[model samples]
Each structure stands twice: as C-alpha cells, then as structure tokens.
Target: MSNWNGNWESFARDAELAAKERLNEVDRISESNQWKVIKAFQKHRVSDFHFNSSTGYGYNDRGREVLDEVYAEVFGAESAIVRPHFVSGTHTIGIALFGVLRPGDEIVFVTGKPYDTLHKVLGHPGDGTGSLADWGVGFTFVPLLGNGQVDWEGVKAAVTPRTKVFAIQRSRGYDWRPSFTIQDIEEMVGKLRSIKDDAVIFADNCYGEFTEEREPTEIGVDLIAGSLIKNPGGGIAASGGYIAGRRDLVELAAYRLTAPGIGGEVGAMLGTTRSIYQGLYLAPLLVGQAVKGSVFAASAFERLGFETHPTWNDPRTDLIQAIRFRSAEHLITFVQAVQRAAAVDSHVVPEPWDMPGYENPVIMAAGTFIQGGSLELSADAPIREPYIAFMQGGLTYAHVKLAVRQVIEDMHSRNLL
Candidate 1:
C-alpha cells in the first residue's frame, strides 16, 4: 500500500535507525527540562486564579505578575517581563536594546550579523525610520571565523567606551552555521567581561529556549529575549514574547514595553493567561519532540549526500536543521514538499516572495495552526545561491517522520532525488 520504491523506503528506515541514540539523548534532555519547568511552577505556587484575565489598566493582575516571576525563575534570571503586547520576537529584542542603550551608546554583535529582520531594526544612519541608527545608536558586528566560531580579536578591536551592549544570537537564523551552545556562550561571556566589565551582555534567545538544561542568563548573560510562539510556546501560546535577565535590565525593557511610569505594573492578559501558563508547562516536552525531528531530518538529508549543519549526531543547541540543495529549483521543490505534508494547509502551496526585512525573496512553508509559529513543522529559505532549506519544529516525532517521507517521495516523483 506504500508508493515509495525500495531504495527510498530503505533510506527512511536507515535514517531513523541511525538517529536512535541521538533521539534517546533528546528524550533525556526533555525529562530534565520538564522537571525544571515543573519546579518553577511549584515555586510560584501557580493556581487557576492566576489564569484569570484582566482588562483596562490591569493594575492588579496577579496572573501577569506571577507569569513574570515564573519566567525569571525558569531562566535563572533576576527578573522577567512576559506579555502578549509584544508583536514578535524582533519587537521584544528591539525593546530590550532600545530600553538599555541611549542615543550615544553602541551595540556590538559578537556572533556575526544577526538574522535578516534585525538588519532593519538596526537600520542605517539617519534612515529616518525611528530605527536604532536613525535615533543615533551605533551598531556593528564582528564576523565569525571561517569555522563558525566567534572572532574574539575582532570583538576586542570593535569594542569602544561607547559600546554599551554586546549581543549574542543563540540560533543560526538564516545562516549555514552551528548554533552557539550554552558552554560557548559562557566562554564568550568570560571573554567579554574581561574586556569590558560594565558593558551589558545581551542574548537573542529565539528558537533556542528549553533546548538545553541551562539558559544564557545562568551563564552571566545580562539580558535575553524570545517569542512565545517559538520553543517557549509549546505550540500552544497564541501570541506573545518574553524578556528575562537582570532586574534593572528587565525593568527597563518593561518600561519600553508599556510606559516608563507604568512599567510591568499594568499589562492586561486579555484571556491569554491560561494558555500561556499551560504552554510553559508543555514547552519542554514539545521542544524535545522538535529537536528529535531535527535530528531525523539531518540524518535523512546527510544520507542523500546533501550537507547538513550539526549533523544528526552533532550536539543540538536549537531546533533548526539546515539542508543544502544543489539548485534553486531543488530548494523550492523541497519547501513545497514540506507544505504538502502540513496537516493544516496541505492544499496551499508556498512560493518565494519579496517578504519584508530581507535583501532577497524568501520562500516559507508554514501551514501551522498558529500562523507563523516555527515550533510547528515548517521549512523556509531565502532564494539565494548554494540553496539551503532551514527546517524546524514538530509537535510530535511521528509528524516529522511523515513529513520527511513525503518530502523524499515528492522529490523522487519529480526526478529530483
């Protein structure tokens, strides 16, 4: 009753079998992270009353207050701000940067250029878009070494007395490089502290939460931000973002989120409190499932002689799995195959377009229940050379396996495999 040829079927079987040990490792991490989240919930004494929504000024919203406390405890940060008001991960990160840096201050990225969206946020000098550069905040980045490691010498040379913040991006974003591990961040923190103890060390934690036992905050990161729809959402949080780190830094970000006088004291949960709480409870296990899916994807593609970052057995610090393709057509077909396997919108095919905030057109295969939630099964790529598709997230390992099979079968049908 199967349509696959013997060779393709054998490839699928071999890929799964090869990923057994890595999958087991992912499960262990899930167990540990799940317990950590449970303990945070217990420490906060979370109750049904805390899920109640608030309206108007939301002056005394206990649910909102407790959510912040729970996130802070979970991330091992001095304080946190969790709110539905943040439109996206980029917005949350923008708030953190703007809140901390004054007009004359500068932010130096230690992990090479950040994801494409942030380029606009960084803006150009006097672009007049109210972006950082337009507002007089300086921005620059130290390119990573050829091996994808941080360029410490470049970082040292880039730093100035005006460098108020040093940023580290935990995920690879659209790049074909290895995501930074907690240990790597710890080392970077040490190096940066030695160079400039007063500078604030910030982390862009999107697509990276719950993937490891400890977060960047635990390793001395001064601030961190991420979207709820990514790993922390558990594929359930409808919309929101969170910022966690030092108490003063979090408060400053909160001020930017609302108003300076109000700060975190007033955000209405708007009936999303319950789902957000439950989502945090489920995040660890769901993230583990996604990571397992990424491992399987890596193995499957590597077996086909396609290059993969953080190969199946390589240590995974995030859910993203990048697979290189031979041509633009091959990349487009692969992404379309991912869309075909989507449970929500299999009938809707995706195409490359001039999506905002990037230099080139991008194709995305979401078809997720939560619009742009990457924590659900999705694939995307910018239409560029040495074409690569970045795939991430699956609510269950089974869904990912099915999608991978469909992608292979589709490619074969088109004589692409």
Candidate 2:
C-alpha cells in the first residue's frame, strides 16, 4: 500500500486532514441517530426471542411485529413494515405508491424525475407491465430549476384535483445535483401542503437514511421508503426493504406487500429477524462511516481536478459521492479501480452492459457480502455524456480511504487521472 506513486499518497492524506471538521459533524449526527435507534429498541423491548424464525402462515410473529415497531420509532413514523419480501428499493417504493394510489389519481414529482430504476415502475401508458401508468395512476414530474431547486410554479401548475400524491426523492441518484436535506424536505412539504393540503407527500428515503438528525417523516412527509441493504442494513442485514410513515399510509403499503386482510401480520421472518434488528442498531454509525468516505472521496477527487458534487465540506444528506469524469474511459477506469480494491471479488473486472431497469448501459463495481449491498463500498455509472460515477457506502472508513488511494494510483497509472 505504501507503493502509491507521485502525489497520490499525499493527496489522500491531505484530503482526510482537510475533511476533519466535516467528518466531526458527520460523527455528531451519527451519535444523535444512534441514540435514537437505541431508544427505539428500548421502547420496543427487543429480545433474543424476537430473533427466532417463523414459518408457514407466520401468525403471532412477535419478532416481525416488534421489528416494525422499532423501525417506526426510529423513523418517527406512526407505522412501518420491514420485510425481506420486498426485493429492492425500487420494489419497496413501488409498493408504497401502488398502495395508496387509485385509478384517476395522479402523482406529481416535485423533485424532478426520480432515479432511473423507477422509470419502468412508473411505466408508459398501456406498456402492459402492470405499472402505475397502466393502472390509470397518471404521473408527471416538475423539473428542478437551473440551480437544482424545486420549480414551485411548475409544481403548482402541474397539480390538479387528480393529484393525490407528491413525490420527493431524498437522494441525488444519478443526477448531478445536491441531495435534499431534511430542512429542504420540510420546506417542500410546507409548499406542497399549501397547494394541495390533502395530497400525500412521499419521500424516497433510499441512500439518505440515518445521514441526518431528523428523517423526512419527522418533518411532514406522509410516507417514506428505503432498502435495508443500503443505509439501514448496516452491512449486516442480508436483504430487505422498509416502508414507514402515517399509520393509514403504512397500512395501505402493507396491504400491497401481502394481502389486504393479512397486512404485515403473516410474513415469515425465516430467521432474518436477528440481523435486521442488529443492522438497525448499527446503521447510524455505519452510515456515518459511509458519509465520511463520501467526503473523503470528494476532497481527494477535487484535489485531483475532477468535479465532485457536494464537495468536501458541503452538507451531506445521503451517502452518494458523484465524481464526473472526462470521458467514458475515465469513468470505467475509476469504477474498475474500486472493484480492484474490494475485499470480495477483487479478481473480477466490471464492464458496462445493458442492465435491467436502466435505459443506458451501466457498469457497477459491487463486491459485497450481500449482492447489490451499496452499504459496502461500491461504484456504478450509466454510460452517458458528462460521464460520472456514483460511489457510495463503506462499512469502515479505513476501507474507503484505501479505495480512494487505489483509484488514484490506478487511474494515474493509466494516465486517466
């Protein structure tokens, strides 16, 4: 590791030193969120018995029930559903949307277009995949202004009597923009409420979990959803997703997760209860580590003259650290270097391909214990102009630091840095 050539080693060290203040702030947020999780656990009386698995109809699954309570408490929501049954973040968000929306109801995206993976779920009319559009739940987005702020006038123009839900994506996703902070979401909730008091405000709380002192639900978000394997998983949860918010909205999502009469009551834990519980317990600190990694990456990349969103000292509301590259080759090199630094699957090389649920070919470097676990160090990018790679997650800050050094060395060797 000491073999780093040129200014790479110094760049890494200087980046860490430069980000000290911001890293401390991240720690404070983590500490607060940690206490919040512990309080929730204490309030719910989590126990070893709750870790035991259930089978068949899974009636009287105390573990599952308590897990829900703990999540609801942590997120400051009236109710929650934590289930491995929901496959991915996109799936979880889809369930939440489908739960409360009806034919003729419309969804207005006040935060601009959501992540690319959700496009298919939104679907085009009559596409026949049974998407929301196919079900007659119309959807449209009011693009953000040039400054990446919400287009309030555009949102007001878009809302109609049919606008039943207003969606907000808490993360930057693939966009080269700032991730919305809790305060930002609160302001948006206020603005949206003034326009349509009855419309449900939904937040896609994907990579944003535990990154702030308060969650979107704590402000005014009527519903929020996220994947356990991302932030809340703490690199321990094998698989799962969660939906939390108003009691009625949560119940509606639960109905969509299972059946109407058997909402959140009948799903078998299948022995995943323990990790899920422990994952949530560790999520706050783990999320802090990931956020620190993001900051370090931003600082280090900025020193190397690359463009980074949410620069080193900028406020962090999510784990993603997007670095724009000069070309697709540079982006690919950066992603491949991240894979090389992985403890798992270090020998495998990543290449862009037509990944499902994305319009563009994509490349990903995910060498995680759990497949697609972004909580572990990983980087991915869609092959498009303004080539950018979105790097997120690190179970340990040390690993993230090492990955940055490795990326710098590898890219420099190829003359791409």
Candidate 3:
C-alpha cells in the first residue's frame, strides 16, 4: 500500500495479524470466563449463528416468558419487554421516556447529551420543529463535565418533585463517545435515588452492554434500555428494542405501547426470538473480540499518524473508536475504503447518506438498509469531519480484524497512505 509500511493495506494486515495473535488469549476468556455465566440463560442457536431462548422465542417477540429470562440475566429485573419493535435505537429511548412520565412530570437526563438519534427523539428544537415540545410533554438536558462525565451537581439542581424520571445514559459511543462503566451509572442512580425515592433512574444502555463490570439494573437503575440488535442479540435480532426494569415499569411500558397505540414500539416482525437468542449466546465472546479489535485498530490508527479516540489497550469500551481524517473528502473516502473492504455482498455499496433525525447531515458508507448505522456486519462509518467512526457488531471479533484489514487496504488502494 505504501512503502509497505505507511499504506493502510499493510496497516490493516498488521492489525488483523495482531488480532489473530490475541485470539487464544481473548478466546480463553470468552469461552470460559464469559461463556459459563451466559450458558445458564441459553436457549438455542439459529441461522447457524443466532440464539433462541429456552422458552423458544426467537427475536424477543409476543412470548413474554422468554423475555423475562433475558431481563433477569441482563438487568436483574423481575420483568422486561425485549421486542423486535421500535424501528431503531432512538425510538426505543422515546418509548421508555413516554412509558414512565406523565405530561406534567419532568425527566432529568443525568448524563449529559444522549446519542444523536436519542437527542432528536427527545425532541431537540435544534433539529427543526418536532417532538415533546410539539406535544405538551416536557424535556430537559443537563450538561456533562469537561471530561464528559455527568454534572451530578447540576442534576441535583434540576431534580424537583416534578421530576418523575432521572435518566443516565450508559452507551458512550455517540456524541463525545467516551466509554463509562456500568458502575458509573450504578453510583449515579444510587446518589439520585438517595435524594428522591419516587424518581425512576433510567439508562439508555446501547452498545455498552456486556462490557461493564456490573449491569446497571444490579446497581440501581429503575429501567435499563437498549437495542436488542446491538449488544444483547449477539449481532443477530434483525431489529428490536428492549426495556428491563422493575416489574411495574415493564408493565407500564407495555401499557403505553398498547394504549391508543400511543407508543409504536412494535416492529413488523413480532417474532424472531431465534436471532436474539443466538445473539445473546455468542454475545459475550463477540463483544470481547470486538473490544479487542477496537483496541488493535485504535493502535494502528495512532501509528498511521491519525488522532484516535479510545486507546487500543483499554480494558473497557462501548465498542467504537474513531480517527480524524480532517477533511470531508477524506472522511467519505475512508468510509468507502472500509466498506469496499468488508462486506461479502457485492450489491451493497458504500455511499454518503443522511439520517432522519440529526440536526446536521450525517453521512455514512453503509451497505444495506437495516437502519444504516446498525452495529452489525461492519463497514459503516458515520461522517464526522476529520473523523470517521469505525465500529463493529453482530460478527465475531475475528471478523472485525478482517474488516480492519480491509479498511487499511482500502486506504492504501486510494493512496492515502
């Protein structure tokens, strides 16, 4: 690609090679340490890859029984609603917010800004006239610290008796995108609840699942939410959203979805328990490997003379690390390079596109339409000038290494070495 040293092809190769070397080291932990805990909750595998719950539900559908098991396992909740409903991650956050609060009540988002989609779903006026403000409901945002941690003091100031929900987001792969552990949320919830007993501490738990030392629900979140397709579904669950919390909270969310069809948390396919089930089984291992890949890629990018976020050897991550290309053209071309390298499907092409709910026009090199930024199969990078986010999901960490190689090769082919 370059002097055989500077080009990305060589970079990707070296990165992938590094990943292979770590396989035995990482797999040992994946197969034994992580696998043992998830096996008790295992149902079955599907599509030669996905997991089906013991209750026989495939993608967390109409059957409430299996969802219960998943909730217990992931959130330590008595009940949960893990449905292939809610078109995307943002929709899921909206459902949880609506499920818990009344019109007169308020929701104090503890952790600063949410994911871009969630930011829009929460109805930011900056997104151009939509959302809770259009309706009678209220929404407020609390700023984070310089380091990106929550301004707990500000949260305390914002919480009033009118605050029915105090929400903290766990997934750190968006906005400022720095990973925070579940322990962070647990401690936040504890502090918030100590002040207000009736308030529900909520978590927008997205790409951050299975990487934490402890689950948020175990620590104290009244409700923990995320996309089943992202972390829990093991890169399966064609599409879905999940909410796990206290039993009453889950039931309340269900009622909101059913009531007047007020909340549209339902996806076209009500049942794919298989994909989600398998996703969970492969989850621990896939996540470990993905994290490992991130570490490797971050190091390679640093060596490539690019600014990288999230160091390569970090013990914990939300599963995304980005490098700055500094120019719009470079960002788009980089995305194209990675996509050209990753997917098996020839029909899928990488292109710049806009998302439905972001303030700025976010471009991505996505191959298919399973919601462009899906944390599956790889090769999707969202546009951030001077920065392109390379993320992975739904595939083995081994696959992530291959994708990294492809990205490096693509970079070399384009002569950006």
Candidate 4:
C-alpha cells in the first residue's frame, strides 16, 4: 500500500480512523434514502413495461409519462418533466427559466454569480444565442455576505414588481462557500414569499439531490431543475435532465422542452427509460457513497495541513469537496494525480484548455464510464488564483479513498505536501 514518498500508509491509517464515524453516518443516510426510493418505485408500480423506450414522435409513451409521475411523487412536486432531450443541467435550468419568465421580467439571483455555463445562457441582448437577455428578460444578482450567507437586506432591496423569479443555487459552484441545506432553502422560500407573494422561486438542484432526505420542492420551492447525469441519474443515466414543480410552471418548461402544443406529451426516450429508472433507484445509495468520499477527502486534506471547505464534520448537502492549494502547480498536480488514479482513463493526462461555456481555461480529470458523468470519480479546477481544486463524486467509497491517497502521494513526492 506504500506510494510516492512511502509515508502514505501512515496517512491512510489515520484517515480511515478519522473518517470511520462519518462513513457510518453516511451509511445510515443511504439506508433511509434507499427505502424512500424503493417505496416510490413500488407506489408507481414500475415494472418491466416501464423499461421499454420509445422513438419517433414518442406519442402514447406510458413509461415516459409514469417516470415523471414517480419523480413528482418522490420529490413532492405537482408535476415533473423528465426527458433525454434536455442536454445538461444548465440547459434544463434554461428551459425552466425561459418557460416561466416573460419579456420585461427580471430574474434575481440570491446566491451570487452562477456557474460559468450560465453566463452564456444569461447572455446580454443580441448575443444571438437566444439567451434570456435576447428575449428581453433582465437579470440581477445579490452577492452573498462576507460569510457566504445570503444577504437578506440586499435581497429585500433587489426584489421588485418586475422581479418575476428569485433563483437559488443549492450547490456552491466554484466558490469557496458552503452549500445551502434544506433548512436554509425553507427559510429563503419563506422570506421570498413574504417579500413578493407572486414571485416564482426556482432552485437549481444540481448535485444536491439525494444528499438530503427531502428536496427543495418538498419545502415549497416553486420549481426545481437538475441534470440526470449528476445526482438523480445514479451514475447510470446516460443523458438527460429533469424539471419538476408546480404543474403550471412544469407545463411551461415542458412547452420549452418540446413545443407549445406538444409539451411533455411527445419526445422519445429512445431506450434510456430503463437506465433512467434504475439510476434513480440507485441514486440515493451512490450519492451517500459520494458524500462519504467527500467527507473523507476533506478530512484527509485538512489533516495534511491543507484548507478544505465545509470541513469533514460540517453538514453536507452536496458532493463537492474544495481543497485550496498554495500554488497553481500544486493544484494542477493534484488534479493530474486524480486522473492517474482513474479506473477508466488512467493513461490519459488532462491539461487546462478553453472548455466551452467556461470563462477560464479549465482542467478536468473525468475518467467516468459515462462520458462527463460527475457522479463518478472526477476532479476539476479552473487555472486561477488562490489555486483551489474542486473534487467531487465516486461511485464507491473505496475508489475515492484510493484517489485521495494517490493525490497525497503525488504531492508528497514533489515536496508540496
């Protein structure tokens, strides 16, 4: 088990001991979540017939329709639209926004600037990609306070009659802030309702699903959107996204996804129905493993004198574990080392390049079985100042533990540890 400078054995021993209790807790949560999903599946009578996929116009797709119902029931939403047509998490979120917002309406972001992919989606007027701004919708953001908590006073000042939507991002994108919990969302929903009774509150629920027993929709969020490849897909959903919430709001999103008349009635599943259902069935357990890996990684990094966001003991509502390095080289090496430890593409090296939809040159180490699947073992970071590397996901805790050890050994060999 010795690696790099040969001190990894000692570190691994400590990490295992330190992470024992946390891992047990994760196991407990996984059990509860597994039961919940099982009940949802049973309640919906998901049988082999639901596994069949559709093609062409995809009309009379009972499996597709029932999957939505099961998801709605599980999430406690009035209605849901789950489709392979929606490309990524950002695209699903875009559909939801465009579906609800009208021309001259304003969208207020209470969680600060969103992830890089969103900048293009929220493009300025005439950028010509048919962005919100191009559609004559306005955007405003209220920066979080020094502590990364939402600024209540700023949100109050920002809300207006024209503010049709108040958006909340549960996961802290590339930022060093803590992810918002269910309780936090509940409070935000309550406050927003008081401020503007009619304002729609949409939650970007990417990477946050299954981490908590309850979802944002269960707590009164007007609408919620997530990518299937991230959390809900359970690492098996090849492609797709989900938008669930109030029936009217979901219907609007469905129109955007398909057409004004077709809505969710059309769109073929194309043989992905079974995988989607199975993935959702397994998501809770996989998410728990990922969360445990995150906790273990955070503790391991912190023990070695590196700074980790939402320390190991902190209540986790997402899978991201951000580790700050003193230099860019240290950060880059850490990412490269994770790639070296990959089960799929271990031989391939990753370099920082101009990735689409990102403002900065980014480096990503994703050797997942499913291309671009973040729920599997992966690590990525922007080549930027402060040199923070965000590591997330593992299909199994054993794999994540191995990846973290490899990173430590690589850093130690370079005397960066």
Residue range 94-163, candidate 2, lDDT tens digits: 9999999998999999999999999999998899999999999999899999999999999999999999
Clashing residue pair totals per candidate (backbone < 3 A): 0, 0, 22, 0
The TM-score obtained by model 3 is 0.82
- Cα misplacement distance, residue 298 of candidate 1 (Å): 0.7
Model 4's TM-score against the true structure: 0.97
lDDT of 1 by residue, 181-263 (tens): 99999999999999999999999999999898999999999999999999998899999999999999999999998889789
Off-target runs (Cα >4 Å) in candidate 2 are 1-9
Task: In model 4, state the lDDT of residue 69.
Answer: 94
Backbone clashes in model 1: 0
Per-residue CA lDDT of candidate 4, range 1-417, in tens?
A: 222345667777777688788778888888888998889889989899888978899989999989999999889999999988888999999999999999999999999999889988899998888999999999988999999999989999998779999999999999999999999999999998998989999999999998888999999999999999998999999999999999999999999888898899998899999999999999999999999999989888888788899788888899999998899999889999999999998999999999999878999999999898999989999999979999989999989989998887788778886
Order of the predicted models by lDDT, top scorer first = 2, 1, 4, 3
Residue 205 local lDDT, model 2: 98
Which residue segments of model 1 deviate by more than 4 Å?
1-9
lDDT scores of the candidates, listed in order: 0.92, 0.93, 0.63, 0.91
